[model samples]
Target: MEKSGLAEFKVEIVESCLVQPCLPDSPRSTLYLSNLDNQPLVRMAFNTLLVYEACENVLPHPAKTIREALSKVLVYYYPLAGRLRKKEDGKLQVECTGEGVLFVEAMVDNSLSVLGDLDQLKPSFKQLLFRFPFDNALEDVHPMVLQVNHFTCGGFVVAVSFNHCVCDGRGVSHFLKSLGEMVRGHVKPSLEPIWDRELLKPRNILVHDLVSNEEKIECKPHSWTPPVYKESIQMSLILDFETLKYVKDGIMPKCFDICTTFEIVAALIWQARTKVLEIPHTESVSISFAVDVRRSFSPPLPNGYNGNCIVAACAKAIVQDVITQPLSYLVNIIKKTKMSLTNKYIRSIIDTDQFPLDVHSNQANIILTDWRWLGFSDVDFGSGSPVNICPMHWNENGINASNGFIFLHSPERKDNGIKVIMWMPSQEFNLFEIEIESIIRKYVIKGSKF
Candidate 1:
């Protein structure tokens, strides 16, 4: 049975087919992916949701225009139309088959209001995105897939799923911007697509080992099995600029250099989460995140360079120290670890044979990533910019066992501050909330709430 009121909704697919490139003579050869792209951490596919509200001028052809625009955009991002194949050495490469991507046209049973607030959403997998009919290996999968679901109120949602071997967050954002330009009647993308994947290949130099041995053992890139839990929930922590300013100002006097918003917030969460978990005092706790290395290059890679250009940045401390020390201590540790990611550090990780995946299976670890400045808000297809953009949490058959924190930039809804989305076991959520609130009150003000 469906939920009552605005929450009751359903999606039905009206059409599904392949959307090929408009150009006939796309490149027909194999393309080598970088070590960063081939690493075990980003070996799977991920999905993102872009929500658009009703617009009188663009209501009639929401799916038609996007389908046409995708065809044109694929001409430039040709690799996305191809498939991935694993080489003899176990590294994956693009086959450049130009087979095309899956595009689905769907319709919703109700208006956009049926979904309620996008900023604070629960997990729902009612076929908003296209799922492959048959199970297949990564090589047999389509490089990219998209679904556009039209609502009764003239609003629609664009859900995209793509393999990580082709591009990272920045690279995909660039592609969406180009596609949006095409939807608005631009013949060509504003920026030409660049596939210089070879530039990110590791140099033939001795690898610099920065991470500790404990991290290597814990974060080793191997097949992962999701841990079974009684129940889990998704929660959001909204910190506007004013709240952030107050928190940072209260703590800056005790730190070395002024800590960044990410650094401070990440540290706060790590502390709060660890306290709630009740881990042993002697055990080690780790926080891992991706650091963009695009600018770290001597001659920076062009804005259009579409490939993985980030490396794992990890910081670790004992549980006792983390729980007992001041928040500024963890902030300093994160700052130092992130600052250590120089061009040399990036090259060393790439050049090495075994680059460890930062996400450890250990229960005491925290994985955080920042998607606040990926240029998603600027993407306007014909109606206008999307009213909301967020990662869709789907747990069909428990295939998606992602347990981590994502930092989102909600300028309109969050008063130009940041929103942190967290997934964790329900049993500990109340305690975690209490811990976070206490920390905020202790540091920011007597009665402030996060």
Candidate 2:
């Protein structure tokens, strides 16, 4: 029996198998991955869980329907059904062997209500997804894995884990959308999948040589080291649109002409986290976020072209300025950093292979990625859209903590607010929360600026 924080329950796996492409003549050729896709930073598998409430009179079993839909969808996104292989040059490519991805049908003993708060990532949530206990390299296992766990209340959870090296958040959402389309009885996917990885190859003339090199950070080869934390936790913080607007209004007069909600909220959290960590005043701190470059290119990547199209955009400043400066000061730094992500700059990143090396080495760095715009909630699997979608948060060996921030939409969808989920050391989390509340009370509640 697995114990969720809210209750004790058991998840029994009923069936597990490889789901292959439905088409008999699916292509069996090798596909090259782009430089962005081959980066070491995104080598691991990422997991997410989608929750759907019980339907009144739906007849077909959810797992059967989803499995069939997945098989059909794999015909279009065939690379997902393939395995990742490494070349002599140390880059990754997909071997289209039609081996297919893993699919599991599971049954949970408890109802949706007994699962407790779906918003919080709990230990029992691990049971919702199939777990591999044995040590196996990524190339030795399936690239895409899905498990459909049916609750006693007739609801189900679609927990999926896919290789991040193949595609990014947007790309996965696009693939999921296609699977949903198949479940809804669509003969063909609304949008076709495109594979133009070669188009993003380094050009003849290097971009850095042609442009100013001041912004170019030294390129460093990424090395993945398993993390170990003494004590860690994940917490969620909600900030309503009203509160954000109030803070922005107070700071806009002191900062740039336009301030986005993301900029304002991110700046506040960065300031709070930096202050709580008590970083050295002389140390250099950075805030890194992903910026999509699909539309930034000259010809503009096609609509269906889903690959890793995001680049890390970073804002850097001394620790003293990050903590002591006004909130608007950090906001301006963030805004300016984002505005600097011009088309040429994005090209330079690919051509020079230079990414934000600071994010990996700097102890004071705070990394954030926004899921509010990722379109995960928009995927419908015949029982209507999922009520909630969240990451499957757990540490390897129960001691490793993923340190980062994610901006998610309000689960209830009743308000214009967003949820910021953060993972850090447990002791630091308390102090960080205090700093956040202090900022909110000072600025939004009392109409005072920091």
Candidate 3:
């Protein structure tokens, strides 16, 4: 095995296949992709890592069981087996030919001890963890791929790669849970996947008469490739309850008794990330975050609707304005931005098929995505619950490593607050860490009744 600058290991590929439904369940008709599903997912694969401790040794015959379960699950999620092809109009749709999903199995020479904490998946470590061995060029056609890596210490990691066009983080969790159910001897999934794109299809006529031109959505059609920050690194930070409560109380309005957790956390991150970068005070910077539109729409999306029902909410400010503002000031901005993500705005964007609009953000143009309720903990494949589940960004498309993007998620084992995993320029990371810690510490001191 040729080794790079990162740790070296001999990876042996045990098996590879295009897994299809054991029983024949072909799509009666071609599936037309929905507007929400037609987003960036089509261009790249969203990868994830689930690590489990080596308590039981079931390596004897987990293969046939796993394959059979995947086949059963595939019967319901058939689009995974279909091909995404562009139509005459240049829009993409799925040709449900039941070609099947790519599945790979490999064995690593090392153990979890050598791997340490997987919370922050560095690029070098990511090389061993990525699901598909091939490059991003194959993602558009191969919508889903899987890899199971067995470590020498008996611990194993399940890596999955699926197209972003098919679904968002919630949908990925749903698909994985289905696989887990099948792996645990259930013939059918707990929640059946719904694939009717017409549910979100735009009406032929303009529906809103009272809406003004100001609220109209903008369409930006341009090919964006993910940015590559070769010099940047990923860092994970845990926000405890005391830190969160202090910050939230500091930001909460006097008249208001409470505020959302996201508002306070987002505000702190926005300010800290921007300050650490030491951007010019006059420069305009924006932050991009995603808001789920499933329940936000007039009629809620189906419970099992697996598609990209998310929109970006962006907020911008001059660098000086952000750095000088009080924590409450920034928190209010984030709250107001979220409040603006109304059903009206969501419908407008859906009807126009426009790009996601910026909502609440940190300058230096950092992007933060919330995945607290994605339910990765429930994804147990015959073994006990996973010790850690880290998401790998869709770096192939427009999600570059140097973009200062981060993910905020609930702790792996039920802690009060959230954790952040982000990638940024390595040079500023030390100061960035200090800035964030002190931000909370300052709030904690201020919130004292004294």
Candidate 4:
């Protein structure tokens, strides 16, 4: 199973689907960014591209085929563009180029040993991916950055960088599924893409009237920041469903029958992280989650409508208080925060005139994103689907914090439990490991074979 062999297969798939007949040009469209505040909107416009490979029979071929497949995929996304505008009332509106979209690639390297231990791979991949340099290449024709020389031992890595405004995780998954279909010989996508940007139009020209018009926006004049930490961060342990459920159930007694896996785990992590970081009680920390708004669209976005359909929900608390609080309290905080996510909130965040540019940057230390319910395992790329599909990094907008976590459902595992993937600074991670193991040991009960 050499990289070249896999490369050949990749080429065959791309040629049969893309190169032979040439892809049809996507319709011209534009996204209106003027509605969105500068910093968060720009952050939303950038996306991450991921490459997954089996340790056995790594792709073998001239990097050309892989690169070609990438180019072809971009062709499919090209028609999508974004627009930034301010209305007469100074309301910011984000309009998508419904005609098409754009994407960027993020790359990383892994080892056979890392794959052998899923837990280690999870965090290691995240840390490596956050260091990806796509933003530095924003001015390039492709607006894509390559993360080469990642995942070096007993395997190879694939890099992808995409524009954030074009799509969210679900939308990106749709595109990947389409790419897999093309690779597997589906000339016509089973799921036809739906591109009606008009549907996303805001009802009022001035959506969020509360945001002050005088707030100033700020952003890094340039993309590309040095890695947050110099030391290499390795993946930790994988918490199986049985263990996770045990912990969740144990905490449920305190939560009064209301709490999601995300809230509980988030509380646990936040507590541990604050302790490890040794932050003062007065320090404010928050947990930001991404909320998909496709369902909120007037008619609900069509099944294959690919573009950004997400918003952020932040739950803030004092550093010391969050750590000492009961799981139930944290659950309530999360629920209340989620309830506040509305079209108005989305518009408010997008309305640069209302919200200050610094709002997005002043978020909490811990960020959580849940893909457990996203049904990623159903994404079959023709080769028996993925046993696992985890995000390689957390660099997307609000989630790219030094301490970030993503929740994923293991492919077809009967345990019905979710896997928690976390990344943090090496020192913080070590402290986290100690706290997590202690919590599990104290609160979790082992289950039958799962």
Candidate 5:
């Protein structure tokens, strides 16, 4: 076999395989209890398997070529092929004791569907990789769930659901890109993965030690104890770049030039939510923004580095203060928080070795994580590219609340704008919608002068 450029790789469908499960001993079995702080974090691993009708031109033997590529990619993630375990002392650990890949067949035809709606075919894929069924001890050995479906036109989609604890968004993307490169015949990966956990080991910082008494204070849940609230949430209303720009323009002029789309929009929504919820002015609210820390490493993490490489930067203030403060002030605070992503801070968190295991109840909170910057648009599963991609469901890390928000680029539009999909309580959603409408209307007549 001659070395070829990435274009020489082929595509084919292979039956997904499931590995055999291993029962943990009494001491090792206890690790499962610690993950119960929220829900168990499991990684769903799958690929959109598309068979190319044009494979004759692309390769000599499509099936053989694709199998070779898959083998190569699998070897890279070999270190991660294991199940999570807990020590008797409650420390969580991952043991690489699993083998073989789990797979299933798709019920639908290869033609007549689009690649972007790959998730739609999950129901018929039949063989699930992992399900959290308690006490049965003989748990399935598959670490990731596989969804195989055919597109309406002719192709297949392989989507994997990975536990966030196993890898973060960046890590997953790196794995996928490497797979794609292997398929395309790029034998040597551009960014080799690093597995030395010691590189991220935390130093001794009394205030930041995760297991220390003082560090536990920071992780302790807040005690607001407000009336219980609940609401059904769904993904709706996809906005284009122009609409988002229009909304941003409306709020920018009210603040100094330093304000960002996130802070401005967050402020408006926070104010509207307070009024609609009829929460007292004295009550405090906080916005939790997920910040990527890839660049915070001393020498900077490699592009292929995976795992949770992010931290949350939270901004808290009374509802009245948020509504009354200049947008500039809020923006400045956010900027300062972002600047805190120094190596010291990251080392502190990683060293504390404590995952944020508890949810703060006292703070009225909302989560904002931007997928726009994640290069989702570049994910090409052999059918042009995904028209749009959004997480239909997100569970794990105590972010299953109704107030979470995930923003992605609008796949329908080619412009440099963003689409925000927010999951807020019913009252908060209504208030946010009304304010957004008003802001859009206001910006149409008068643009930002800032």
Candidate 6:
């Protein structure tokens, strides 16, 4: 059993296999990866999505069933099986020789109940259940890797890691749902992926205002695990739809603006996070959030065309400016930033041909990720809906702790509010909760004043 301060569980790898696509595109050719696929962090950031499926009657044997299904799903996703290679012009492309995905079979000699609630898993607890266990060698550079953990009580966990450059969250969903279809004995994936990277290639002459060379946001290295520990001290706050409407209503009259849930959430959390950092009032605070450009394309990225179709937008202002001004003030900044993410903005980002890095604002910087209603609950791998679907928390060491971030989770079926996952030093835990709740409470008690 591997142990951390939080929990203990024994994980043993049963087998490792390279599951290639059942059929590669005829007359193998190198796939041209577009600029959307060439972002620097795309290869650097390994996205880990953990799916906790509860106990089921006569659970399917995972090793045999999953491997068979995954093989079939890869038929359409064969590019993932190939390794990422750099071309002569410094662009990244898929070598499509169909080397295959690294699939691991593992067993957890424990039950899901013992793991407790899926939402509150700490780093140590997470490490135990989902093991990719690669040594960071050149050989370990895979576009995708999956680990299936079978529990003693018949429930299981699935962890999928993918290079952000090759695909985005939505693409992962398409692939997984396809795998599920195969596991359930379907002949084909319900959603067939359309791979036409040529369609997304950038223009000959680039034009973008937000991410030009001189205006770019500077980035710095920080700890993924802030000085704070992601223990039970890490908790969640639920802002129901009703409360959201109330809060939006409150901000409207005071800030004189209509606000979406995302704008409201980002504005609220940005100020609260700034306060937590305890930076000087005059210090500048920044907040950046991801925008999906799937619909921004002229004809739109084909249905199920999930690659890295994102460009980050940010609002930067002095700490006092963000907090003391009406909530509308901060909301406007965020809204303007979003508005700037036009098709030209994305084209300018692609023109950079590097990670369109969000320039880091030194103090109390926050990255808000909205993952609500992504429809992961609909992905059933032979069982019904998963009890929980969580991305690995950003608490790992070396992701700048100073610049705070939030990944907003989808509201559960039984719940009307959003669930958020955040990581920072445990010492600031109380301060953050108080700040967020205080804002929510103020609006709760005193209705929006016209």
lDDT of 4 by residue, 76-161 (tens): 54433323334565443433333222222222333433444244333334332224344553332222333322344423343334
Task: Name the 10 consecutive residues with the lowest summed lDDT in model 6.
Answer: 212-221
**Candidates sorted on lDDT, descending:** 2, 1, 3, 6, 4, 5
Please give the distance, in angstroms, between residue 441's alpha carbon in candidate 2 and its true position after superposition.
Answer: 2.0
Error of 2 at 244 (Å): 0.8
Q: How far does residue 219 in candidate 1 sit from its true spot (Å)?
A: 16
Whole-model alpha-carbon lDDT for candidate 4: 0.50
* Candidate achieving the largest TM-score: 2
The C-alpha local distance difference test score for the whole of candidate 2 amounts to 0.78
Candidate 2 Cα outliers beyond 4 Å, as residue runs = 1-5, 57-59, 133-135, 210-229, 356-358, 400-402, 446-450
lDDT of 6: 0.67
Ranked by lDDT, the better of candidates 3 and 4 is 3
Error of 3 at 12 (Å): 1.3
How would you encode candidate 6's per-residue C-alpha lDDT over 1-450 as one tens digit per residue? 011133457778898889988875622668788887776534554444444555553346876788988888888888878877777787777777788888988887677655654445454455443333444633458888888888787778777877777787777777888888898889988888877787777667745454532223334333322244443233455667777777777778655456688888888888787777666665566777767888886667778776777766667777677777766788888887777777766666676564445544443568667766455666787677677666664433423343444444544653566766665555675788788887777777764442
Clash numbers, per candidate? 0, 0, 10, 48, 31, 17
Worst 10-residue stretch by lDDT in candidate 4? 1-10
- For each candidate in turn, the TM-score is 0.91, 0.91, 0.86, 0.67, 0.71, 0.86
lDDT of 5 by residue, 41-111 (tens): 22232222332322223444433444455456656565445565545664445556545344443434334
Scored by lDDT, model 5 comes in at: 0.49
lDDT of 2 by residue, 1-450 (tens): 012247767899999999999998989999988878876567667788888888863426999998999999999988888999989888889999998889999999998876654545556667888766437765787878999999888898899988888888888888898998998899978987887788788787846443432233333332323234575656677788888887887888889768998999889888998887676676666788887778889989899887888777778777678888888998988888887777787777678766644455554577888988877888888777788777765655653244588888876673678888777666777778899888767677664545
Runs of candidate 3 exceeding 4 Å displacement? 1-7, 40-42, 57-64, 119-124, 127-140, 207-230, 254-257, 356-363, 394-400, 408-412, 446-450
User: Lowest lDDT 10-mer window, candidate 3?
Assistant: 213-222
**Top of the candidates by lDDT:** 2
